[model samples]
Target chain A: MPKESDDLSTLGELGESAVLGRIFPRLPAASAQLLGPGDDAAVVAAADGRFVVTTDLMVHGPDFRLAWSLPHDLGWKAAASNLSDVAAMGAVPTALVVAIAAPADSPISLLEGIADGFRDACGALAPGCGIVGGDLSVSDTLTIAVTAFGDLAGRPPVLRSGARPGDVVAVSGALGEAAAGLRVLFAEALDANGAPDAVLASLVRDRTTAQLTPSPPIADGPLAASAGATSMVDLSDGLAIDASRVARASGVRIDFDRGALGADPDLALGGGEDHSLLATFPPGARLPGGFRPIGTVVAPADDEGNVSVILLDGKPYTVSGWDPYTGWKDSGVAGGSAG
Target chain B: MPKESDDLSTLGELGESAVLGRIFPRLPAASAQLLGPGDDAAVVAAADGRFVVTTDLMVHGPDFRLAWSLPHDLGWKAAASNLSDVAAMGAVPTALVVAIAAPADSPISLLEGIADGFRDACGALAPGCGIVGGDLSVSDTLTIAVTAFGDLAGRPPVLRSGARPGDVVAVSGALGEAAAGLRVLFAEALDANGAPDAVLASLVRDRTTAQLTPSPPIADGPLAASAGATSMVDLSDGLAIDASRVARASGVRIDFDRGALGADPDLALGGGEDHSLLATFPPGARLPGGFRPIGTVVAPADDEGNVSVILLDGKPYTVSGWDPYTGWKDSGVAGGSAG
Candidate 1:
């Protein structure tokens, strides 16, 4: 009899179906998981009578690179991306379903590594939130699609539209590390065959770690909700971009004090993939620990309903954060420092 | 202002964020879609106070190839795989969230074609169902990941563990078309420059069509549930293999009558990817239209507790079905009269 490893090549060798067989057996049985991995779909008991759902897809080049990131890191990133959406809504993630597409030649170990990453991330983010179900198919590239479900605990879901003028702006969790980490990875890859400075290398590695696995402050989302947060959004597409969304929805302008932003300006404004909660609170509201005041909201400009960022000196900053259409260039200094 | 066509490039050129921006505006608004696209997560209403969920991934090479399949077909297959799972649970598909990963150099039109495929498939299979949200990223290859949600409509979910001895076996749709289609696609790709026979060529074309865009018969799943199916599953991995699963779960033997299993033997027992519902009903129970009787359940044999396949003429046919570890050739031709 062939050993299991011999019987099953890496996910790439056995293809999608074989990989699924390996994964299905290891999952925990849940009452909510009326149907598990094998069938067309898995049925879960949607407690609170409603389910909060979100999805994110991670691709190889733009989202990750097998050469630079481990399978586990990919898994962690995939789970965090979806779970953060649940957190942004002030809901507790309960379950997740993943859809992974990889080349037929991908190794089984890599698939397992990705699964392990998912398990580790889930364990850290939401205990018991295991992968209830997913589908695997061969594709030209490696892609992960994840959908996360959460329970609101019957509380009204927090949305981006709830902010009002005079609401205090706040954020939870660090920003800019992931973006900075990505920069380092690219630079390192470009200068292959030569070693960089030890300290610089470590700094780059730390940033990449942030890029690969983001820890969304789930607790802070619920904390803000309980404290009567007026509006909430996750800092995924940079603080300025996401905050602009909140401002547009709430019909307000958000003014930022560069001094109040964390030690990193880039981390606060243009940094992305942070998965932090950027929220608003009414004046004099007592914020939970880790929740720090960053800015204030005011009426939107008469010509535009969208949010505009104002500096402490009351001038609009020329930088518009990260825009996918317009590429990001190193602006002389790292963004984490005060402007 | 460049024309959309001139401006468009492969998904890779636009990058992850740009692709997202292009696709996000095309989606329709649904009350159930609390948050649509562009966030860490999307919020959907699971109105039945419960949510039925399932996911599937489509990869390149193994699941699909760019040479024979269009981007639209890939999209269709991705959505179909997940929606079929929802149908297997006797649930009505309501919404879908997709995550896509493709090479950075992939054309935006191809991505749009993939989205169009989702839109078209959803429109045809479940009209009210919508592609509520998604994420796009770049990878070394093209991969599609989809998660589908369904409503139970107050009916108890049909599971795979409810089959009993003396239960009748039935299926609701055509089988073997997808496997047949795959064979054609490979054969054509292998002989890309050669001219094949007209009839064979047409069949191959049809087969590729079937494989590229599987039309999962979702309605039958719910019909079986309403008609009191004792046990049920989708024919994703061939009948003999899937039947064995039901037998093991229900502690019974599933004896398939070759005569009653449609007109094609290859389709009846060995073909996979049909996405047809195979269900068990009480003996002499009324079955929904299109559900043809194919087998019967019997008491388990020996102490192994494994489901055994009893063939016509008192012969015991060892289970032969599609297994990734061992390719599908033997299973595809086993227990069948070669034309």
Candidate 2:
């Protein structure tokens, strides 16, 4: 829990306007915003006459536990996750509209910290991209829902279905670090009875930071698009699963060279939440900076049913990605709180 | 609880992909969509080089009760609420990106009904505006967060601060009906102990329907803009409070003729969630067909503090708007479930 301060008030004490007043100043201003908060809606410049949009939700129980994530980390992760989606469309993020629902007793400092995180994340990851507007509600669960918008800059969107048989699959940003971080957190968080212990903090800071606040290569998306990437996807649900998505969409099979994947290839293949850019470039084409060759697209086998096929060193890789519902039950976290 | 059927499997039974497969077919197609769902993000056309964006959250406890709100009603109300913000900007809604977080055991039919609600709401309220993309997550509380986008269509956005002294205050769509409906629902929902029984339906079907499924005059917004509305606001809050917002924003005091507010002016002044469009037109300007004049804006009084001033037939109207945090406690509706 956040340290209680006499200066800090709770949402229950300070009404919506007062809470927003405290947060708005901490947020970064959007370059594309024509109108910001305090209105019914915000107007953003979609300079290219088309904009890419996506939304993602981070809920308290399933997505993150307050014990594991600070308010700042929650905001950073939420913004980074949604921003990665906008980048995956091969678009430069322009603005974000965030909606948060938290318990009435949540401190004003929590929201202020969230706003600061949004400011810093946008400043670091995608300069000029900032929060345009937001809404707040009182709820039992702390839910953060963000919708990000991006400007394509007149380039055609690079889609998952556009890959061909001979394309080389490349990935930008770290693959397995985030999942490794999650493991570190879980191991440290669990008590003797295997239930989560809220008091514990992960000793592995780097891996924990990667899991908590990932910095996806936002610029690499448009760079790959400019370099004529045939297909692209954000590595949100592990390399193997996301690669299969591209392969299935493109009617091909992906074969990964185990050596090409960094030192822990198994973790790279099965771990999730890296938010890396995975793009397929034509053979012999110049790979964009930050992207490393990971796999190759091949024709689907005739006898095998038309299903997602992923191969690791010429053998079928059967490991799957994260699924929230099943994962929640499988993890045995039990409830919303450790207490 | 929704009726159980052999075909209606729960979300836990069918993973995200299968659940999405069921919902995708039921959602309406967006005319402004360049690329739709199933991608990392959706691309939407912003023909005039700008788009209006807004987000809202509807959570289970403070926002609605599942006992009273059917899945379809939840979906319809959520869409209508967000769409009204887009309309309030004097823009035509083009697309929505929705993110929903529900318990793992939630029925797939609940999602299907929500999808159907989105389809029907878009069909009736804002034709051609549909769900372009969405995300799903598992949570203890069922939360629906919607971000709506609208095309400006080459018109200057009508802002809340644009109203000038001598402007005629006008409104389109009925006020207080939704709040009245809430009152009806509360009366019927409470048992002998004054706790929510969650069994009885409101006797006043029209009022309950009004509260559950509102049809705000969306088209009148642009019409009012075309007829030269100086300022505009969506009346999700009570008329007195929303008018106060306009009064405060424009640095003007609004004097409303109580008789102009249909029967039960007190209800009109204090009730909320009607989602009506409240606009100001310059004196002698032609009021749009559906808009009825309710009040007039005047210069701020020299003696009164520089705060929101709203007069109901010359006396100060002290009733405040809804604050979710305070209202959640004030209503005495404890816990997520009635049980």
Candidate 3:
């Protein structure tokens, strides 16, 4: 076997079992978890007698890079991505299964770091959400896939299709922080030597932390469901795009107040991976705490089978949100246009 | 952006969404599935109101390779690995989520093939179990991570630690086929130019198929459970190793009839990835069809917690099973003594 020092930067630094050991200790115990890591499978309690499931994968390079993230960051990000999906449905995350592929020659410390990352995210974001079980295999590159399970606690799940035309649009948590963080990380002017130490540290911290590991507003999701939110989604593909999904699913148009969105419009409209809860409520329904009103669901315009995002002044925004199929580029925002 | 002929053989050849599209259609539709693939996450109906979850990762090189297997095989293997865990619990598979990492230069056709592999495996073994959601990203090598969910149908789950002395040891399905197949694939003699077409085809087929895609006996697992088997496990790490686990957990020593292990003893004892079901039953319990009596559970002779597997004439076979931490060669029959 190669010495850890020889490839400490790679995932081979830590062995799979050792990596799991590091993360397992940090996880909180959940009542719903019948079995946690170290078994063939995890047994979780389904209080409502139904389980909610979601999965997401993170690959080194396209999704992330070693130069931009630490192993722990990657782990945290992997867990958060799936956990957020569970949260999107107003479900309580119960357990997570992680499968990681890395090169044999990669340092084992990288795997340890990745496990730590996953544990850290699950620890803080969804306490008691243990790493139930997973598989490890050697690969040419680093890849982490996480599957998360959640419980509905016997309540009907709040889906994106539940929003009605008269529903009030609202959001929990700030938008664009992750996107802004990414921007600062990629900004040429913020290089280590050129930028102020404090500013650079803060920027790097936010950028690397948020970009590498997202913090999903899981707590607010169940609260929204309790507050009778009509429809909801986790803002992964920017607000405009995801909100459009809700609008189209509910057969309604959504109108957003530019003032309510953060100072950066791109963060609200074009930013991806924030994982904030975007929800809608009946006009008179009780709203959850920390939820800020952002927009309103409205009747569709002349376009058939389409959901458009109108601006504060009742004009449509010409620029659509991010599309994975189409390359991303800067575009001027316009009023009264369909996305 | 690269053409198919550009030699990029990486994951980029298959776009992430496109890969999902191929596998989504081939899965069996389960009534427990509230939503199938093509969404942010799949919602599965947990019949007992709970779920059994597990995950496994397949990485190129350590787990598989392009030279030895095709992309489709990797997909099937990844899904099967996790599905085996769910089966180990005597649960019915409900849904699956996959995370794939590949190089950008890979041909899209390879991704489609991988998806097809997943579909094929699910169709044959886990009908109604589909890849409901997944993430795709570029990496240096091909990595597949699959998370599987299962429903228990309200039966008390059979755990590994429930065995007792005097319990009859039995197995469902074939043993050692995968390990034997692997050996055939690696043997130099089999690669000779003038090898018989039928024999060579069977050998190659067994080796290639077993190595690339292991079919876990999911059906037989629940069957054993319904038959009142005391303790059960999936033959993932090999019979001796996994049986020892049952012995240790149940606080009993297990003795096996070497002659009854089938035509090949090595295949039965130390073969890994056969994905057969091993269970312990009461002495007078009626054994289910397809279940072959192999041994008897007895009290541990020593305090070391070592479970002995004796021969038919009462001779001790000291060889243990495979351990991931240890090299595969050391755990084989030829290299080590049976315990």
Fraction of native contacts (fnat) of each candidate: 0.69, 0.88, 0.65
Model 1 regions lying over 4 Å from their true place: A1-9, A12-35, A103-108, A183-208, A305-313, A320-339, B1-35, B38-40, B188-209, B303-307, B310-314, B323-339
Q: Write the per-residue lDDT of candidate 3 for residues A1-339, one digit (tens) a residue.
A: 111123344333444445555546654466677776655677888777677787776765446657666666777788887888887788888887777766656666676677667777887888878776777766556667778878878767788788887788999865766766666665632456643233444546744556657787788887888888888888876777777778767777788887787686645676777788899999977788678888888877776743244445377765454422222222212112333
Encode model 2's per-residue lDDT on A136-206: one tens digit a residue. 99988899999999999999998999999898999999978888877877777777887655567544555
Model 3 chain A: lowest-lDDT 10 consecutive positions: A327-336
Taking all chains together, each candidate's TM-score versus the true structure is 0.86, 0.95, 0.85
Candidate 2: segments with Cα more than 4 A from true spot: A1-6, A193-195, A304-308, A331-339, B1-6, B193-198, B202-204, B304-308, B331-339
Q: In model 3, what is the error at residue A330, expressed in angstroms?
A: 13
Best by TM-score: 2
> What tens digits encode model 3's per-residue C-alpha lDDT throughout B1-339?
111122343333343445445445644466567766544566777768678888877665555646566666776777777777887787888777777666566676566667777777887887877766666665667677778888878877778888888899998766887777666655622336633233444446645566557777777667777888888888877787788778767777788887788897756787787777788888989887578889988876765644354433355666555433334223232222443
lDDT measured at residue B252 in model 1 versus the true structure, 0 to 100: 75
Instruction: Choose 1 or 2, whichever is better by TM-score.
Output: 2
Full-model lDDT for every candidate: 0.70, 0.84, 0.69
Deviation of model 2 at A292, angstroms: 0.7
Give me the candidate number with maximum DockQ.
Answer: 2
Ranking by DockQ: 2, 1, 3
